[model samples]
Target: MTTITTRTIEYPADALTMIGHLALPADTGRRPAVLIGPEGMGLSDVERRRAEALAELGYVTLAFDLHGGRYLSDPEEMLARCLPLLADPDRMRGIGNAALDVLRAEPRADLDRIAAIGYGTGGAIALELGRDGADLRAIGTVNAVTTGRPGDAARIRCPVWAGVGSEDPIMPPAQREAFTAEMQAAGVDWRLTVYGGALHAFHHPPVDHTVPSGVGYHPQHAQRAWRDIVDLLTECLPVTK
Candidate 1:
C-alpha cells in the first residue's frame, strides 16, 4: 500500500466554519491537488475516502465541507438547504473559493495544478467556481450539470467533464442538452458520459437514509465513473514524479 497521511483542516465560508479533509502522499515534493465536493448532504466518509484514494495516486487532495461541516441526513432538510444554495451561483462560488483558499494555503499543493470535482450539489459548486473564471486545470462533475446564467459558461477556461445516470430525473435529457449547448456555445472542451441502468447518486455507496425519489446506487457504473474522473485528472493535471 502507498504511504499517505491525512488531516482535518478548517476555514471560513458564508458565516460558517468549514471543515475540510486534507490528504497527502509521503513524497517530499509539492504535487498536484484535487478539490473534492460532496453531495448536498455535505462531506461524508465517502468523500474523505476519495481524498485518501487520490493521495494514493500521488496528488494532494482536499475534501471540502458544505453546510458548515454539517452532514444532513434528512432529505427535506438537505433539499431545503441545498436548493437555495444551488440556485445562487455567487453563494456556490463563495463556498468553492473558500475551499480553494484553504487548499492553496497547504504547502503540499501545487497552485497551478488544481482540479475541482464534485458530486450532486458539490458538483454544481465546482461548476460555479469554473464559471467564475477560477484557474482550474479541469472540472469533473457527477450528477450536477445544471443550467447556468447567460454567458456564464464562457468564463470557464478549463475542460469540463460530466457524468450522470441516464435515468436521473433531476438532470434529465432536457437538462443535459441545455448544459451541452452552453458548453458548446462557450467553445469549452467538454465531455458528457451517461451511464445506463443508473440513477442519481449512482456513484454513491448504499446509504441508510431516504434521499428523495430518483436516487440510487449502481456499483458497476460508480467504478466506471471514478475511472473516467481519474482519467480527466491524468490528462489535465498530471503530477511530477
Candidate 2:
C-alpha cells in the first residue's frame, strides 16, 4: 500500500507559504527524498499524483506549492499570478530554499541523497536551487526556463536533466541551444531530451485546449519523461536494500 502525508509548511519570515504532500512506500525505511516543484498552475491533482507515483519507485517525495493553494485555469489568470514572482528573483530563491528546508526536516529523508524536479516555473526554480549551490544529487526539469539569476548556472554541482518539447513555442530551438551552451560552459554533467510534436505541459492530462495558446496532453512522452527522471534519480541516489 502507498503511504502519504500531507501538511502545510510555512516559510520563515513570510517568504511564501506552501502546502506539501509527502508520499512514500508504506513500509518505507530510510530513502532518498525528492523535492518536487509544481507547474505555473500550482499544486494540482496531477502534481500530487506525480509525487505518489515517485513514491512507488521507493522515494520519499515532497510536492511543494508556490501559490499557496490558489490555482487558475485561465491563461490570463495564471500569468497574472506567476509574473510577479518571476520578476522577483529573491522570492523565487526563498520559495526554493523553504521547500528544501521542509524536505531536509523529514526524518525519513536521506539528506545526502536529496534531489529536485520541477515543471515549467517550478522547473526553473529547481534549476535555480542547483545554480545557487544546493548540494543536490540530481536535478530534472520539464518545459522549464533557465532565465533566473545571472551566473547561477556556473554553480551547479550535480547532474542535470532537462526535458523539453520540440514544438513548445515558449522554449524553442534557440532558447534550448542557449541553455545547453550555458550548461556546457558551467561544466555541469547534463542531458537534454527533446520530444518531437509535443506541446507545453505535455504531462498535464487535463490541459484546457479551449483556451488560446492551450496545451495538449501526450501520455507517451509523459511516461517516458517520468521514466527518465526516475532513472536519473536511481543512478544518482541509489536506494540500499
Candidate 3:
C-alpha cells in the first residue's frame, strides 16, 4: 500500500455542519484533486478509504460528507433524508460546492485540475455540480443515474462516465435511458457502463441492516467500476509530476 496522509475537516453545508475526510499523497508538490461523494447512507470508512486510495495514486482527495457526518444505516432513515435532498438540484449543488471550496483551498490540490466521483446520492450531487456549470475535468458516478433539470445538462462542460448494475431496480433501464437522452440532447460527452447481473448499490459492501430488494454487493463489478472511474480521472485530470 502507498503511504498517505489523512485528516478530518468540518465545514457547513445544507444548513448543517458537515464533517469531511481529506487525504493527501506523501509528496509536497501540487497535484490534481478529486472530490469523492459517498452513498446516501453518508460518509463512512468506505468513502474515507477511497479518498486515501486516490491520494495514494498521487491526487489530493476529499471525501465529502452527507447527513451531517451521520451514517444512516437504516433504509427508512436513509431514504427519508436523501429523497428530498435529491429532489432539489440547488441543494445538491450547495453541498458539492462547499466541499469543492475546501478542496480548492488545500495547498496540495491543483485547483484547475480537479474531478468529481460519487456514489448513489453523492453521484447525483456531482452531476448537479456539473449541471450548475462548475468547471470540472471529469464527472464519474456509480448507481446515481438521476437526470437533471430540463436543459441543465448542457451546462456540463466535462466528460461524464456513469456506472450502473444491469439489474439495478433503483436505476433501471428506463431511468438510464432518460439520463442518456438528456446527455445526448445536451451534447455532453458521456458514457455509461452496465455491470451485468449486478444490482443497485452493487459497489457497496455488505451491511448489517436488511437492504431493499435489488440492493446488494457485487465484488467483481465493484472493482471494475473503480478501475473505470480511475481511468476516467487519469484521462481527464492526470496528476502532474
TM-scores, all models, native as reference: 0.98, 0.92, 0.98
* Cα lDDT tens digits for candidate 3, 131-241: 999989999999998999999999999999999999999999999999999999999999999999999999998988778888999999999999999999999988767
lDDT of 1 by residue, 172-209 (tens): 99999999999999999999999997899999999888
The segments of candidate 1 whose C-alpha lies over 4 angstroms from its true place after superposition are none
Error of 3 at 125 (Å): 0.2
Pairs of residues clashing in candidate 2:
none
Compared with the true structure, model 2 gives a TM-score of: 0.92
The whole-model lDDT of each prediction reads 0.94, 0.81, 0.95
Stretches of candidate 3 off by over 4 Å are: none
Candidate 2, residue 60: the lDDT equals 83
Backbone clashes (count) for model 1: 0
